[model samples]
Target: MRSYKAKSVTSIQLPPRERRETVLTEAGHNVFNLAADDVFIDLLTDSGTGAMSDDQWAAVVRGDEAYAGSRSFKRFRETVADVMGFDRVVPTHQGRGAENVLFGALLDDGDVVLNNTHFDTTRAHVTNQGAIAADCPAETDLTTDTVGTFAGNFSTDRGWDAVEEHGQDAVSAVVLTITNNSAAGQPVSMANIRETAAFATEIDATFVIDACRFAENAQFIKQRDPEYADTPLSEIAREQLRPADAITMSGKKDALANIGGFTAVRDAALFEQCKQRAILYEGFPTYGGLAGRDLEAMATGLREAVQPPYVAERIEQVATLGDLLRDRDIPIVTPTGGHAVYIDAAALFPDIPADQYPGQRLVCELYREGGVRTVELGSFAFPGTNRPELVRLALPRRTYWHEHLEHIAETAARVRDRRDEYSGLEIVWEPPMEELRHFSAELEPVA
Candidate 1:
């Protein structure tokens, strides 16, 4: 149920370039043999469920052993362990599911979760558990004080303040998002993560990494840091991950080829307890609601996720998009970390009132005009109402190439030119169609 308001909006009628039509697949309609140069990138969706190698399919086709009897759980456990060096691993259906099971299991009433910034789902999970999610203003001091919005935002001092104000018992954990999505795809340096993790440990609280884009974060760090110039990407990621007591990953983005998520913990007791909750919400402790196929793809994807070339390629593509957007003075979060291009709508559309946040305005306008869809990162995603607005353009994982970027850039240029026209009405949304979910914004888009 979407709410709609009758407002005249600008329209862009450019024909989207077509790349490839099809790729052979046993799953038929379920998979798209996406050419590397497709124009319409699916940013609003998850990583596609493309078909995997014949051997991968065979592994999935043989599920029983993969799930329980054979050291399937152990193998997956060791996979997580070898990389993260965590004592135990507990697989779940997806990242949010892992968040739900883990938070629900750990948080009681009045606990607090502190993070540099938060993803929508993570905040909702904390709130749902009757816990408070607080942000410690972090600033990424890459250079001097001229800190970028995305960087230097995760500060250790603020984290200390949070725990000092709210006693250790009141603070359940400090969760760090690798590529802090809400903060414009900005990644925390290994130094920041380590300091934050150390601070959390000092307060006797659990440290968790929302490692949805761990590999991307690793690339950003390596490219940005001189000290890490010689270190391998895998080693850097493992080091950042080592400080956290547990990690929650979205398989769709970084681990599995398709959709799924898993959580791992270093403490034996915590791992056992989290696994027990997984049985309740997820599936059995062994498989945890994933199909045989998903488990197999995930196994392969996890291995590929750490490969330097695989990680580097995706980061490069996203960086390309970011560079293009920035070149046009489109108000993008420059020095883009990895994975996405974040447009600072407020800066771009300064005249638009905060009450009618221009970012939301642009999102609606772009969709109506070019049939391009994107998620709005604004107050709606935050716990409290009236937060700053931002528009996030999540690059489709390993999809599209130079030509696809041209279309996106063309669309953006058109949108920029027509920004004034869309700003005319200053359309303010009425009550939302859906109750405020975390990151998702369902609004009334009327013509």
Candidate 2:
């Protein structure tokens, strides 16, 4: 394997223990509220937190800043069409922006959008438009210990149950999230993608994909799916997306770019509708709320992301982290996932109840112990949804090396040693928006 070396470095410092305690208290025990300077290793999210490649930076200088019909936009559109097999592409500032535009145009009141599992922002966008966001994850998805090749597959049984209750016409679109983030970052098999597309077709609903980690998903398929073992990564990616009528992508993930995303569609009419909504909510069709330089970088990054070496290395790095934690008896999602290692918070702190926010408490302790920040995906994030309590340690693309992974594992082990000393948290204040309250909600240790 060829090692990719970093050409630039940035300095970061870990604040003292007393300072971390003070900052954690002042920030209402939320890692999101902490300043960047006070943190040592930031694992809050992989979204736009990666280190862009030198080639991507070079493309940035070559960007054409024209307001309309820019050269950068042409390259970006061409890349999407060639790689994703979608001719109609509309740029967006990020993945959620693409979701907002596509959902705004396609969905209506009382409509339903089904998925394998909807991430935080994706579900919020659907419900915000007065539509129902229904998730139909496979049974194995919830069982963190069960090892499966494609645990991210959508459950047709559950989906059919939803259809029977709501009627076929109520389902506006069936969206499949590749490498399902909400399900321990599990990968959706190519077979499942085709099955999902067929389900959408039978119900006369559009088939869409939330393809934030399309490349990572394809890499998994190549490694696990026997029929595609000899297929190239780029070809596997195209096949993975071929069943979709449209796709919403987050360039921050697989694309390896700092910013930029797009909505690509097979239908011309739907493309036009998405473009109009993009204009209303984002910006001009050419740039969509982002600079031309960002479009150029995204175009370059998209091509770079699917290369065999890059995709293999990215998945291997994540597996290494999971292995380190597992060796220490840390309860993580079995078989590991593509991008992040999900620690089973409930198992780690059996004494802490779900309603009391065990995931959030673990999140606070990880930071307080080693200045390593992560996010909780549990009752706090989902509120009344009753989702499993898991703490996600998302590793950014090419940002941290083996040493960093070791440090993260050590920090987790340290917390596990003193797990009994920790307690749960209670939400003291939160925003009015129920689905989006986790971002800014304030919490404290339960009395």
Candidate 3:
């Protein structure tokens, strides 16, 4: 494999000269509350945090800024059709915006939205519409001690049963989030996707995909599925989307673009509804919450993201970090996810009680001790005890070389050394009742 180096230049100071106390005070108790200037290594999210290639920069310069039917939109649509086989495309500012439009278009007051794992924004959008956001996560998700090949799979039987349990009339859509983010970034099998689609079809339900990480999921399919071992990444992706009636995407993750997303569907009526909602809420069809330059950049980045070398490199980078953690006998979700390395907080800190939120504590500690930023996917991300306490180190696409991963791994070793001394966290301030508390929840160390 060829080694890729970042061509961009920006100097950053290393570890803060001050002690941990000073840095902790600057960071507050919430990772989200911390400013980017204070953090040295950011692992907080893969969303809109990636580096763009030279080709993408050139495309951005060539964008045509037309009010309607812009050339940039045309290029973006063609790329989507080639990658996903969707007949119609509606652009959105980001993934959540796409979800809001589609869920509003399909979901009713009492409708049900089902997914393998509905990540934060998706859950907020679904529930905001007065619809039920239910998860039919695979049985493997509950087995937190072990890992599996497809832990992200939505059980076909469970999904059907959920529909039966909720009544078919109440079901709005059977959704699958490719590379289930909330479930430790696990990949869904092509077989499962096809089967789930078939089951949804049999029950007269719409099959939608939250395909934010479609490229990474496709790479996993190629490597894990013997039948697709020789298949190209684009074809693997095309087949993956074939099972879905529509797809909602955050171009930031897979496309290697900073900001862009779209909703694609084969249903003309549904697309029209999305269009109306989009224009009303977002902007015109041709430039929906994105500049012509963003559209052009997304078009270019999407094509590059699926290249054999790029896909291989992206997955390998994540595995490299996960492997380093495993080498130290650290607890992590084995088989390593495509986009991030998830540290099992429950295993890492058995002394720290779950109610105090060990996952959130680790997130804060990683930032305070090592100047690395990460997010908690456990009780902090989802307000429930059923989910495993996980701290996600999400790697940005085409950003951060192996040296950066080494820095993170070394930091993890440092944190592990003092794991026993690590205390818990308590929420000092939060809304009386908020949609997602993690975004704004204030915290303090429990002495």
Best by TM-score: 2
Better of 1 and 2 by lDDT: 2
Q: In model 1, where do residues sit more than 4 Å from their true spots?
A: 1-39, 45-67, 70-72, 140-153, 383-387, 424-435, 438-447
What TM value does model 1 have? 0.83
| Per-residue accuracy of model 3 over 1-447 as CA lDDT, tens digit each | 545677896665556637545656655577787767777889999999988989999999999999899999999999888877886999999888899889889888988888898888888898889998888888884323557888899987788788889998888799999999888888999999998898789878899999989989999999988999999899998899998999999989888899989999889999999999999877997789899999998889888878989989889989999998877767898788899999998888899998888999888878767789899988877886368889999998877777888889888888888899988888778864355888878878788
lDDT of each: 0.67, 0.91, 0.86
Mind giving the per-residue lDDT tens digits that candidate 1 earns over 290-311? 7656666676667667778777
- Against the true structure, whose lDDT is highest? 2
Indicate the worst ten consecutive residues by lDDT in candidate 2: 139-148
Clashes of each: 12, 0, 0
Candidate 2's C-alpha runs over 4 A off are 141-144
Estimated TM-score per prediction?
A: 0.83, 0.99, 0.97
Q: Specify the poorest-scoring 10-residue window by lDDT in model 1.
A: 23-32
